[model samples]
Target chain A: MFARNRSGNSQVLSTMKAKQKRYEALIHAFHADIYRYAYWLVKDQSVAEDIVQETFLRAWRSLDALNDEQAAKSWLITILRRENARRFERKQLETVDIEDVQVHDDTQQADADVSDRELHRMLGGLSDEYREPLVLQLLFGFSGEEIATQLGLNKNTVMTRLFRARNQLRETLERQGENRGRANG
Target chain B: MDELEFRRRIYADPEATDKEVVAAAKADESKRKFWNEQLQFDKQLRKAAKVDVPDDLANRLIWQQSANEFARYQKRSRWYIALAASVAFTVGIGFTMWYHQPISIGGQALAHMQYAQIEESHSLLPVNLDMVNAKLASFGARFDEMIGDVEVVNFCHLSTVRSLHLIVDTPQGKMSVFIVPERNDIRVPSEFNDQQFHGESIKMQHANIMVVGSKEADLGEMKNIITQRIQFSA
Candidate 1:
């Protein structure tokens, strides 16, 4: 009885250790992209980092529910999206206007081109409906169907949002280019 | 595919490998140029979206998780400690209450009669008036003179109320006298008994005097003697 009890306790301990290892691996693999997605979703770096931390913490708590390793990316995104929605629900009045907050990255701003800065600000200025699908495509390389599934939207809607998102950005860039060209001329 | 359909698909996904869209791009030189330009634009958009993540985020996450787990463990064990402390506190209160439970004076005097008999046999020094007075001084009372032939006198407890016991021999039989301090919480019953002896109590100035003897022995003489002889100082 004593030997069996010891073995049972050891088995539980080993399982906990394995879960921790898997959790650390998940964090290292997805933290960067997850943070970027959160940043674009909220248009605030600190809030994005907070949401990412909360997402990973929640993921750690429910890591056992995740079975397939392939679904991990979408799973993390799902948690992050929910975390963002909950943030709005918790602080509805405190939601920051996306246009008011610049997408600030000190390291990128240090050496990025003038056009790149304008593009970054334009991306941040895009509404959540358009920017979300585009960010998923650009960052995780998720297909339209995958973004639709992650966002709980139809594939056609995801495709249309992606199309409009790029079209709006292209128009903005072209207008900016013309203004700069005319000024130089 | 028409130009509008081609541009729509290409805008949605610049690297659209759909055969129809690819074929349309190849058949029209302008369509091919637009697709390539969109592709280049998508590359820039991808770059803008790839923001820099903080350097120590991974370490902070792992550290925070472990700290949370440690806090949860501490909270659980603290709950158990609180439960055990309250249990210990309850048991301690129960034992103290049981130890100090009230007892009837007559019943205790009768109970002490058996032990008094054994004590009478072992007692070597004959208890005198002065020796009795010395013990009674603590209760602020003393006997004016020897009340009876006190064979043995000692202090004893009747349900946590300290008192003095005096064993005496009389003409009728042996009688036991108990001088219990007056306490409002302790009830001094006027009469009580067991198989071997019966007892009676009298309320005095500073104490209650209980007299116990055999069923046939008259306790009135001992009660009267104790009442008249014992004195409480002002």
Candidate 2:
């Protein structure tokens, strides 16, 4: 009886170890991209980090439910989106205005080039609806259909948002460039 | 495709490899130039979207998971420990209750009377004097002669004290005699009764004799017979 119990305990231990290894691998492979996605989603670094941590914690809890390794990215995205929604539900009164918070600090802005900071501001300036699909496309390289499935929108809607998101950013960059040229001349 | 349509498709996906978009780009140089510029802009957007992740974020996630799991395991084990302690405490209380409980030989004898009829039906052979003596000898006591018509003779325990039980048919009714060895802890009552039966006990040299019968039966006669015929060896 004792030997059987020991073997059973060891079996449980081995499975837990295997699960931990898988969780670590998942963090290593996608934590950066997932964090970046969350950053753009909330447009706040600390909030994005918190959301990413919450997302991975939830992922660890339900790791066994995720069978297909290929589906892990979208699965993480779904969890993150839900976590972000829950954040809103919990603190509806303390909602941070995206426009008020600068996307990058002054020190980081000092290190970046002029065009980089302008692009960052433009990307951050885009509304959540337009920014999300573009980020999914840029960070994850998700196709129109994939973005639609992830965002729960139709393919045409996702395509339009992507189109308009880039067009707006491009138009702002051009208008800034013309102003810069006039100042230089 | 028209210029506006071409620009819309290119703006939507700079890397659009659809045949129509490619053919449209190939058929028009300005459209092709516009697609290249958009591709360069898309590259810059992709680069900007990849914000700098904190260096310790991955370690923190793994560490947090381990810590959370440890906390959960501790909670579960604490619950198990509490459950085990309560179970052990209950068992200890039960054992103490059983150990200190007053042993009532007369009450046991009365309770055994209900099974007396069942025992009578199960006994294959009528117990004679020798058979009764054979079991009574274990208590260092025996009957000199036949006290009555012995129906069933067996050894039983009355409140953890070993005893000999003999069911006999008398002129009054069926009576059960229990020959329980004398123990300091056991309380052999002088008289006891329940709704169905009443019992009388007698303390001898080394054992207690409890005679029980139905409420209507006279136990005095059966008690007198057993007391007169039984002898205890010193």
Candidate 3:
């Protein structure tokens, strides 16, 4: 009778362990956002996918090091950026074509469809220096401080880049609008 | 505020307080409109980059984890089997050595000397003669010119117990015998076992022996010769 009770207790313990493992595997919940952040940073779907895949692989090995569930997205982004930088350090990647920088999406983003094209185009037109901070702050919704930490820049520098990026985009849009008016007038 | 300073504060943080943004906007009407447009653009950009992950990525990761576990299991199993096989092989060898043969003491030394003598003589008769000498040597007996057409010979020790051996011959059909010097009971009477000299036990002076050989052998004559040569006194 005691042996049966002990076995029953062990089975319960094992079930609990299994449930915890299932909960831990819930990293998939954030994959979409993480991919989006990586895609915004690199501006190439294939490279972004590579970065995401590498990030998740490393995350699987070091999942125990991750403390909070809420921090997982940011932690994954940090890993993606580091992996992308390491790739660059190892070998010079071919320059990505601006036209091909559109992120891959199977689902129709009904809300963002029209504005998303313009956003991608505007980002492509900007210099890499301004474009990176813009992507980090605006697209991924990172705070200026978070962007500053990720890019290894001072918060002041991040703020300056973000300001310049917006001003530059505004100026470019205005010029394009004026040109279109002349053609239509 | 100048157009530049007002634009700086607006774009520095997309989610900055409306009061701070409006303070800058109050200084410059055009700059305020520019901040509104930029904020809209930033929001659009954020919307564009929001990702939707595939449903299968989770299942793939789970499968990979299982594969890693299986690989670990196989590696551990191989080591367990190897450990068990090694232990079994050692145990098997130990059991085989235990029950097989009783070790004879002084047997190896006697065999070594016999091998040396056989190599030197190489003759069937002389080799048998050496065997007789070997047997006699155990009892501290000596002989000068004992002759026989000897055949089979063995001078191996029976453990540490006895070093006595045998030499057989076809002498006078079959008879070149000797006494053990230990038992002399047969010498007191004309007491003989069996017919003729085929199997004879005789006591001559100092010892007794039962011999087996050819029936044509002159046992009486051989006994008389041995009795004359042997000394019973000491």
Candidate 4:
């Protein structure tokens, strides 16, 4: 009986170690992308760091729930997004301009690459319906079906929003151009 | 697909490289043109979404995870066994939150000041004032005075005001300047110091310019010069 108990205890210890190993691997592999996604979600490094920390803590609890490595990025993203939403709920976050929150501060944009300025504004201006899918697609590289699953919406709705997001973005750019032209004229 | 359907599909996902979109694009001239234009737009969206990620994020996360695990293990095992561990974890987090509280204003610029060394960004892109002014103008904030050729300048948003963060190369070292729009909520201390930097918040008519420089930098002279130079172009 003692031998059996010893073996069982070691098994438990090994299982715990295995879980730790897996969690560490996940953290190392996906933490940056997770940070990037969180950065975009909250638009601040400190907040993004807080959310990423919480997301991983939660992920450590549910590591066994994730079986497919292929699904890991989306899984982490879903967790981060949910955590971000919960944070918003808890904080009752005010409407801080998200344009500043984009952690993806590419130097190229700072170059004032004029051709893309209007597009940048309209893209940032998109409502969550369009913006979420677009961000998922653009930043995280999630496909339509993956986004649908992550967001708990139908594939059709995700696609429509994705399409409409670009449409609205382009149409908004055109409207701005017209205004600019009128100002110039 | 017909023209309308093609437009809809391309409009929603301009960069869709799926087999169906590819085949459809190849089938017709107008569809091909639409696809190319959409791809070009995709390139721009890709660019605008560029961002900076904190370095050492993974290790920091692992350390955080280890701390929590240690805390949990203590709760499950001997209470005294993890006493030091749990207390350390709690204090560490509390201290960190005190360090990284998502403040109302100047929070992001503060982040740059603190972590630029860790992140190792040695140079800022060459941005003309007109371009910086245009971005600042988007939010109805402008600096009429010439603040000199700062390395980086962009209009950033705080919870309350549209702020501009500038990283200027100074004789002492680099300094981060946040021109934050004024609100009742923003109450940064007039003077503050950290281990590596000492700075002050200079209140302006329509905004507050909080500047942080290396410990050796003369923040007073910097503040006085900036105050004289900056006028909110009403």
Candidate 5:
């Protein structure tokens, strides 16, 4: 009986130790992904950094609650989304001027400026409600179910909004084409 | 075949899942063509939004984390000293009260002259044999009753705010010294030259008692016996 108890105790201790190591590795692996997601949602770099840091700090504190390694990404993202919401509860945020945000030219966007510039203008013209879900889905690559979970909406609602959001973009782009052609003619 | 479902699937990802492909397969040609165009647009949008993270950010975060850890370790060292003092005082109340001075304030070339004054003049010192033994052990030295001979003893304000009692054996009469680390703004008399303090200020140590002493009491010839014995690297 004594031998069995000793072995059981050692097994529990080792499992706890291994869990801690895995948690730390996951934190290092996904820190940037969490930061980028927060940045896209908030659109303010500093706030995004704070949100990501707080998310990871909360993850560290609550590591014991996590049971499966595969669930780490979603778990961290859930924390990030919560932190993002809590940001608005404490203080009224200043309305960001999306139009004034200057995009830095990078190697990725080195192609012709005309279409890309129009796309950026169109994206900025969107209301935050429309732009947010689109960014989460298209940019962050979140599934509809994951987006629904993050945004506190049903999966059906997420799909409907995404559907409408794309239609609006297509219509806006088509309208801009018509206006440009009329001007040239 | 609805216009809305077609656009959502295209915007979601170009290579839709089997469920999506089967749904699109059943759709009319016009709707299918719209999805194909929307899929192309979505690809362009994804490529456009994708950002290259600055390389310096990762390096900076690592450096910041390491520096934060180093700072916490330094703070923990001070806390440990305070904790050890509390435990030793609790364990040896009888011995510490009997023999220890309220504070001990003299030594060889370098002295740690704190304000040795007792609130009740009759109250015992906080140190005992074990406390002395601990210090001696840390320095790899055996505890001696006296500080191996001293020079000066005096009481001076540790800062403009607090008083310190000190003793030193300067060639000038074992000089009593009282050095204050707190009064940063006070002008000292011409007798004491103002030098940047490189010594540990006990006020900052989180100990119940504050230590006030000289900045460079240990240097040059003083280096021999006083190197590791004294605390405070800078």
Candidate 6:
């Protein structure tokens, strides 16, 4: 949505065309990434979808603000994060941890085995602070600095949190192993 | 870096970008094994976190935006039309064959294209296709869902034959579609398009649906959409 330009209707027309191109390109490029990120945040497919839609709509409204195309991924993530936050602000959802909520899909069952399931369950139990950075790192291959920028944490803090996050995950799996060993004995 | 630090770094990020950590891991067999195990664990966590995404989510979002904007534009344009029914706006260009009678399949499309700039304005349709479909339902022809964004969904008085008029957007250009529940008994040709355009009429749910588009358009895909997407109210 470009402002009518003084250059001519052609300028306006070209700008409109460019806007559409940017919008469609952004959707094509990041729809899935945004959708997945939103899904993890909200844990509901429909709500996540609505967030992604709203995020893109906002993106379209201010596409001119997006100067560097390289930043589009984080840019979209920012929009989606705001949208997801808005969702909670609007109304209180059940807000249960997704790990506790029974996923009706086969994705959970497709995990390698019970240990894999426990890992995912433990991941869901992690606080948003640790979970967000770890997911950002894995989902986007985002480095510690990128995660810091994304979450507004210092790079060192993000690395330390990620380090603690992995340690907790290891502790969880080891505890599960201990229980299994005891049951067998 | 020391082995303890190397293992700790691997625990933090199995695929760590730290060159020193990666170099040490590659250089030592124990560090290499530990990193491999951590990498496998990271991969599993990623897969566990993955969820199924909707198949047509992208198209749905695009359509949602386009339809919303089109609705806004239509709201503004409605006033301009309401102000006048002048000679130019009232040209009623297509539907010329009966110019008054209900047109046959091919003629309905042929008449619809008479406006010349038919493809242009026809693309900006009234956004409420359900209302348009209800109007079609009056003639006993309706669709469960639209396959793509349509520009025109209205009734046309081509020669006196009342028919449902539709112009759906195609990749190459706009394809004019006319559905006549009244003309199934009428003898209709299979299909044809000249240098200027391409068209085909296929019988659907006891209705004559003729679609015509520019030569560049894929009438095959157009036809497939018509058959697959449109289901009778029954």
RMSD values, in order shown: 6.9, 10.4, 15.4, 37.7, 22.5, 29.5
Candidate 1, residues A108-135, lDDT tens digits: the string is: 5432234566678899878889999999
True contacts kept of each: 0.86, 0.81, 0.66, 0.72, 0.16, 0.60
DockQ each candidate and list the results: 0.73, 0.66, 0.36, 0.34, 0.13, 0.35
Each model's lDDT comes to 0.86, 0.86, 0.60, 0.74, 0.55, 0.74
The TM-score of the first chain in every model comes to: 0.87, 0.89, 0.74, 0.72, 0.69, 0.80
If both were scored by DockQ, which would come out higher, candidate 5 or candidate 6? 6
- Poorest lDDT segment (10 consecutive residues) of candidate 1 chain B: B117-126
DockQ winner: 1
Of candidate 2 chain A, the 10-residue stretch with the lowest lDDT total is A104-113
Q: Give the Cα-based TM-score of candidate 3 against the true structure.
A: 0.54
**CAPRI level of candidate 6:** acceptable
lDDT of 2 at A20: 94
lDDT of 2 by residue, B1-234 (tens): 999899889888888999999999899999999999889888888888888899899999999889988999999999999999999999999999889776877877776777778875335766788888988999999899898888889888776888888888888788888899887788998988999998888889899898888888888888888899999998
| DockQ of candidate 1 (2 decimals) | 0.73
Candidate 4 residue B190 Cα shift, in angstroms, is 93
Candidate 2 off by > 4 Å: A92-114, B85-107, B110-234
Better of 1 and 4 by DockQ: 1
List runs of model 6 lying over 4 Å from the truth. A1-15, A103-119, B2-4, B26-28, B74-234
TM-score attained by chain A of model 6: 0.80
lDDT of 4 by residue, B47-162 (tens): 66655568888888899988998888878787765787889999999998776654545444555566544432233656667666776664455656656657777655555456
Q: Worst lDDT window (10 residues) for model 6 chain B? A: B94-103
What are the runs in model 5 whose C-alpha is more than 4 Å off? Answer: A1-28, A57-70, A93-96, A102-114, B8-15, B18-27, B88-234
TM-score ranking from best candidate downward:
2, 1, 6, 3, 4, 5
Residue B196 lDDT in candidate 5:
26
On TM-score, the stronger of 3 and 5 is 3
The model with the greater lDDT, 3 or 5, is 3
